[model samples]
Target: MRTPLDSPFSPGSDTVPQVWAGRTAQLSDWRDVVRPRRLAGLPERGRTILGEAGLGKSSLVRKIAADAARRGDWVTPQLRIPSGTDPLKRVAVALLDVARQAHLATSREKRIGTLLDRVEAVAAAGVSLTLREQQGPEPYSTLTELLVEIGRAAIRRGDVMVLIHIDEVQNIASEDALSQLLVALGDALTHEEDVEVPGGMLIARTLPLAVYLTGLPEFADMAGARKGATFARRFRTTTLGPLGDDDLASALQPFLVEGWEISDDREGATRVFMEPEARAAIVDLSRGEPFLFQLAGEQAWYAGTGDVITRDQVIRGWGGVRSEAAAHVERILARLPSREREFLEEMAGLEPADRTLTTIARKMGLRRGSDAGPTSQRLDSVRGIITRGKPYAFRHRAVEAYLTTYWPDPPAGDAERESTSAEGIG
Candidate 1:
């Protein structure tokens, strides 16, 4: 049922791959922490996953949601704040989604269903509410009260918990709205107070809810700038970086086995699709970036004719891979400010392995020592472009390649002559 043209590598979709590679430890840590009974004594801090665009943050979120959903101890709806959406409205809808999925008795479902209907009516009338329960046909009052109701329903069903996932969180857009969301989440984890009912009876509820958010690294900076210090401190941050060479090799192994045909000749059988040299070529082409790994493999698979993928096929595929990578790299570069683009172009002129902040400052004709630090910080804010460190290098080779290929000739001045001493990126 397998064809030579069918590629195991998928690009552009953030869904998890067949053989997930290099993230077992992170997945395990979160699974244990989010368990129903184990959530006690656990800090109610948010888990914010920070990474570059294609470094698998969304895929990791999907994997975690899959695991939690399968466990049946939690109701995890994979959600994101859609662009131009009211964050509060989207939050209410997300809660309603989880509410619909929750296992509840008939009486509880009717009550929660009525609450959802009222919340939807308020949204249709274009209004927001504070966290409080409403009487009759009025709105639910606030996100806090709606969240409390959802959590209470889940708790009454047994000790079930709710886990919410929001990706591309930077699009939430309003600081006030994001703060309100945080307050709701904070209250859910720690709130234990009695509330009065119409019949003079009182009820208290404490719901177990866990939240996770994923976005680019600059999102951290954005959160700090737009939302202030308290907003930034609400979440615990975890960063995702490119894999090492060894891990990249391990990730590629499953793809190779699944794609190729194994011959029953030697003790372990011979591979018909991948030669050792070809495998090395794919790994080298990827350069430890997950997206590039899929891109290179996909291009090479399409180039080959028969079941076997040889070194020459990989060579031919590089043309397609380079073309695709160049387009992607150019789009990323086009988003940068003019000065940041100039900084990267200058960095491209030096030997990528030896270039440092000091060398760059001198090459760019900086007059004062104080100027280099701010320039470096500015470029570092552009995620996946230039990493900030001593002897710095571009995070991806494709970025350096695009800059070297498209940059205009150096100006006829001291900077031009000094830059030519080293080889430029290709």
Candidate 2:
């Protein structure tokens, strides 16, 4: 069968993977990490997966849910809230949705009747029966209560697992609320308190319930710092690194079946995708970053002749990719505070700052009298600018290339006009 690469209608090679792979393959690896057996040993706690942006954490979570459903297991309800939403409300809405799905999935009329009856009971007991409007604060407490109710209902239905998957969990308002929710979930699962789901009476129970959270790397540190909070300890933390060579190859397999091929002429393309050099050059340049790999590969594909991607094509495609990356950096820079922006601009002026936070800070004029320590501290505080450890590399290579290469002297207006006119020929 022809795959996406075989079709002329496919998006330009530079398009994001989500546009083609859908969500399945994007998250296939996560199934092993979150398998039910792996989670069985832990007390009723939470599971947290952390990674940088574009690392596919959300894709993994969705895949886990899909896999569970395929196995006839009751997948937990997933709720993705924007960063900084109230945790309680997010939890409440997620539970309500899960309850509704469970009610619908029941095959026996009596079981369906019982599910609906419970849902109605919870709604009557002050849980908002309707889904919240998009703009309002979510009713979190209500949702937590609902989860307890659903867990009980699942127990009665013969050990069905009720999962709660929350994405971008770091954005949840205040760590306290997150802590409370975790504590509550633990208690509900272990002590059988909170929603009062009648512990021993409901057949053999394995606490067939779980919570999964995804977020940036800093989330763990932030949660760790919270005093008297054990949420960090309760969770089995999984840090997702870049896709291994085998996995990366597997991800690209679907494309190879078609006429599209990675040849030896592309810059990053051949180095990473096709060449036998120690680890692909593209991977090195990308630091094995998933989104960057896709960006680089897509550019190489679009620039190649006759659909076969060559190293030269990848090199040529770098310009386009860099342009796109620059746009992203511009947006990020636009949001920075003036002082931070100036600091970043100063660092960007250095030829090669070695990607060390200390070196970049020194270049940015961040020094205290004669001491370098204060400058380092200042840089660390500006999260938007310095990004803690590594000298803030632009999130996109294209952006770095633009700032370092194109920013000095932008294309001439006349040149741009002529280029535009030439493009009109197409």
Candidate 3:
């Protein structure tokens, strides 16, 4: 009897997998750039990660928050962007969740302590109005005061940093709301005030506080492209793309070494192997979108027998999981802006073998293929919809499959061009 252990792969959106493959660049930015700057008491800008759905944006944020929280010197409060409610109140609650994480309650700094207590009281009570009444009329203005005061208090105790993270930023109330938020963060970031230490010595220091945002690529135009210098000076947007071939291989390697447990006896480890063909199938199917890696891996694990996950097993897994995979592709495309979606649809209508940059440009109704080059590359790099291959194609095979299945029929003369071998996606 095959002892079936539950699937080890984490397949849900924003679910950090056991292996946690790829994202070297994002980690580097946090480590080399943000971490050092905050440690040195140097001012740092907010990091905004933008990508399509299933690109691991939220997972990356949560990973970083977990890292920061473990540092013992940083207070990391993470929140998902709110809709139909007071967004600032949601933020207030996130802050209150970690209020005890900072050393703000000390008796030495009465003013800072009192400030912390006031914020703690209002935020803990969940009285949105009470929190707002003490500060400026604008919620952002009130937020600025809260961040600056709390960050100052934290830094005064010891060199500490405050990292505020908000995910699903595209859902933030409105453009005006985001603009105000940027202004508020900019104000708090630049706030350098007199700090009284235990010995009554005062020092002027900038609050070691930074914000991190993640959402769809459109969010760049929302918060990253504000009308003023605040966005440019104090914030940066990093567009996340798919994992490479190596990341696919690396994610599956652990199963081999650890021996996927397959028997009722938990102590005895089954000798599990992932063939090169199995890895290739994963690379081809996932094409680097983070969630697909997990999903495909999960399916492959379930379909395999004995010890090894062979290419045939992987293909069978894909066949079994194709409908769900296509659903994921559909949802991602459904969430994209119309122009972005249309570009993908135009490409999907082409014969997969003919999906060159020039062909895509012409298909997009552009006069010259060169006109589409930058946009195509940007779509690949910024949004990860297209591949960086010579003949540019949908990055994920399921993208082509989704579009091919639902795209409108071609004109009479173009029927030959209409049919795509999207069958391989399964």
Candidate 4:
């Protein structure tokens, strides 16, 4: 008999799960679109992944970076968006750190040495500028210089690719900083130069850098609104959400396909399989949201009794973690703007089959459904908090359940209101 496996699910923020699923379009875009464009020296291209928190935006980007690393690309550490004056200093540090690990020929070593000095100088300048004292060269200027040079050297080598993955892009505070970094990236990407190759002088793209960015849709929308369409249109935008039923099942059954690894140091942490009934039960409990899916999977593993997970075990596991799942949903709600939450509350107050824009408007005491159109659209597009339909729906059933539990029930209809007023004191 085989031992039961440890919890292979990742329930935390930005952590990649053992079983990957439902990202065929995104994964293909990275490989087919970005990878091919980069290799062919076509126009600059990459992906900007925008979604609500816990939709695995960061995790998706990390997965891409990991794939690049496996393909022997020169990859940088995951850099979070910078705050202010020390903008992109993290970029320098991450790039240089990875580059330092390379063992190259003497000439290439000297070239890398020069790049390292520029990176250090850029980092120092940013630090100095942060302290309100400019000692070295300007941070933004030198940052641009260093990144371009790094990209150029990589292209000259003609061996490996360079990938920079950024997380928490919503935290970017400085417009000037963002604009400057974009400028540097644009310059590097569009650079055309004749370099000495093994055979002869041939025109080549100077820098072959690919970027993958992850952040909240709210921030992406706000930045684009503030900084113009360039910020939004810089990359192929992908909006993420919870996995669908089929995809969720795929996520649960990763090991069945072979070559998938689950590494854990715990006793009885080898392998396990779920009955279809059990997998469906877990999926229903998850409400198609990833955080809950992961949380439930994690708890299911802990509460699991045998090598084969049964529906009863899935139920027992979820029973242990339902409260935690509710709290997670509440946190998601608490983070939303007041209007968005109010909209959700209005929707939740109604029956699931009656959750239309008009019903939501009525619950919110608005005169016409059109009055709520913009807000509804914002909620749907910005973070996918609510989806649109004849009878609208939330991104997850758990969210609707959470809202209904706390918010007041829908108010009396027009007929009820008229009936009550007419009969008063009569």
Candidate 5:
């Protein structure tokens, strides 16, 4: 057999994972919430998926979108709210794409032809329209109108839904823009409520538009801060943490058994990817983070030769895993203010087990006042890098190991320093 080379694990840089494990409950729950018709007495609230970096927020959204599209119940156009971009204009263009797709999907007569024509006219005007120059039938209004029209068409033709999947929603810098978007969605639903078709045609009483957004915890907080709690309350927020041990194992199993099948002497040809010891070590190294699982798996896959991957190969692969994860650490640390970086470096010196804020404060030689509370908050602002629990620790073991290289030398009597002097990846 070939090296069983093609990877089934998706680092999610290019493709989604072939075998998605965990998140089944979340998928089902959200699907029902956003399903075509509004449930009796259940409001159509916006859905927000929140998590730290590398927790597969975007991947989960993509999976949901793909499933919805496959059923022909929804037309999902994925959009990203990139930093500093005009979210309104971006949404406008994205809705236009949705309209085009709807146009292609339905026949000429039943199609929302009038709305599609208006969308084209607005889009042809270019995305450079100023707020003052384009006040009447504005971008927000146009989008809402288009969505309601689409919903009306869907109701006429079975029970289709239109869901827009937006990622990195935290990057939308304008709080006003976020508020406007929620309003647009609200307006879309309201408009669909009283539409009476000219030719005695009937439309669904509920709007079929749903917006799903995903971003880091900090961004979610920022959005909430920008808009008041009432505005934030409009979204049904779901926070996802790292996977559990069983779920992590389930996620990795497919990659091994299917992607890297091995030949066993006793069993002829069996699909066992890693030795038991190797699997245990990789799981430990992963520390429940999804991206780390992919990174470690990618390294271990190429580290071994022939059928089974041994514990030794996994151990060796860990060296490369640590290095790659450290690069990520370096990038995150670079973005931190100097004070936060200093706080992390100080935290790194203590034995990994003794990294609580109380202990960390003592080590920094603080008397009455300590920067622990604020500094720890700053560190966690990077999201998922530092786990701010009872005993503070790097979210991943590999991150802790990488930080060991940067620990400052100990004074003669100090007990915290554990690593030799070296230029840490500053």
Candidate 6:
């Protein structure tokens, strides 16, 4: 059976291989950031990898782990959590899962039984074991105990370094929970503390273990800022941006035949893959985003029956592109409160320079004046709406399109007038 990694269209697609070609610069940056410094007998600080959704953050982390494992320097474990659970519990489960998978315990049953034993031990010590319930004051101490145990196990096996990777760090609702978790792990790795009894492990001789956090840019900011001095200062931050034109072409090369590839037909292929104007349109729309570019290409590719993609295919594929963009915008918007959503609707209607607070507030039925100062602050308060200093721009062009199509117009009570007003504003 062909793996999903083999094709872009398949479910469970593992895009890590293509990620190198598509996001070469990003991959290289991540490699430099994650390279262990322990060859010289110095412990490398843990890293926080940041990128927007679908911008290959997870792929970069996976690549780093694969590379590290291949070099035999570390044990890499990937942990994923389902939605709507305390992240600390998710982290605990992931750690236990990693231990079990490594087969350090004598038997499969023994591994889980050992984990349960530790959980009970910690709980009996007044740490909360209730995964779904609120964490008690001792949750941080409990996590600290767990990390110390894992570090001891790693040392026993002669593995001096262990990397625990947590994906989708933004999904966790409690900033304090994340903060507590990081603080506990950071203390375990850096602080000279000893765990006593069944939970206590030898401190100085234990190997170093690092926790890697991965998520969108906003989540990283939230985690870093909310975690304050302790967790924030302990880890390094790495941001992943969009692929450059050359790297973008490289990313697509594997799916294309040698001479007939899109790079060879750059201009014509772009026009075909997007509208005649869509070459620029899609680029502006995607902001050089990897997934959006691939989405646009996929739409055009599927629309074309022959070997070459054409402008007609791109035009036909616009529906698919727009649909994907709308869905993405809805997801982002769903997280916002009603007032913010109203702010977004108003902000979406503004032209590049016209998205100042005065204009947005006026449109949202807030204020009638041309003053840009207070209104700007008010608009800025709306998350994901406008970046500071820059003209109000949707994070993605697909979002702009969605806002244009779906968000109801200001209460003019006239569809024709609203259409005219929207086009005029644009």
Models 1 onward score TM values of 0.75, 0.58, 0.77, 0.81, 0.75, 0.64
What is the per-residue lDDT of model 4 for residues 1-426, given as tens digits with 9 covering 90 to 100?
222454567787676677676787888877877776776566665567888767778888788888888987888777877544445677667766655544322335575566567667655554345345445554555555655665555665765678888777777676655666655555555556565655786756545678777787866664567757565455666678777878888877753334234454565334566777777877777766787778777766676545666665566666667678777777888888887788899888788899999989988889999999988998887777789987898875567656765311112242354345447624
Candidate 3 lDDT score at position 414: 30
lDDT per residue as tens, model 5, 1-426: 214354445553624566455887678776765673352213577788876667778888888888778878565567877897766666767776776666633546543565555556555542344344565466556667778766665655555677788788878776667666666766765453644557988554666666788886666567666665765656777777666667877766754566455455455654546677667766766666677777666666666554566555555555655666656556656666666677778889887788888777766666522556777775564355577776787764444645785311112322212112112211
How would the candidate models be sorted by TM-score, starting from the highest? 4, 3, 1, 5, 6, 2
| Candidate 5: worst-modelled 10 consecutive residues by lDDT | 416-425
**Candidate 3 lDDT tens digits, 24-133:** 88888887888777655677778889887788888997887777777765655567776644455566666654455554444376765655555555454333444446
- Across residues 1-426, which tens digit of lDDT does each residue of candidate 2 receive? 222343332222222244233334325434443344323422445677776465566766766776677766566555665776555555544555676666743546574555445444434432232243434323333344456566656655653566667777767656656665566565554534222335635333335566677776556666666733666456667665555545555455444444333333334232122332212433333334465556666655565434344444444454566655444446645654566566556556775546555665566666632344434344343121234445455433333444566431223353454356447644
> Candidate 4: lDDT over CA atoms?
0.68
Model 6 agreement with the true structure over 115-165: per-residue lDDT tens digits: 556654443432234344454435666666656666665555553456778
Write down the worst ten-residue block by lDDT for model 3. Answer: 407-416
Task: Choose the strongest candidate by TM-score.
Answer: 4
What TM-score does model 2 achieve against the real structure?
Answer: 0.58
Q: For model 5, which pairs clash?
A: none
lDDT of each: 0.62, 0.51, 0.68, 0.68, 0.64, 0.54
Model 1: CA > 4 A from native: 4-6, 32-38, 73-77, 108-114, 122-141, 152-161, 189-207, 255-273, 352-354, 378-385, 400-426
Error of 4 at 175 (Å): 3.5
Q: Is candidate 2 or candidate 3 better by TM-score?
A: 3
Better of 1 and 6 by lDDT: 1
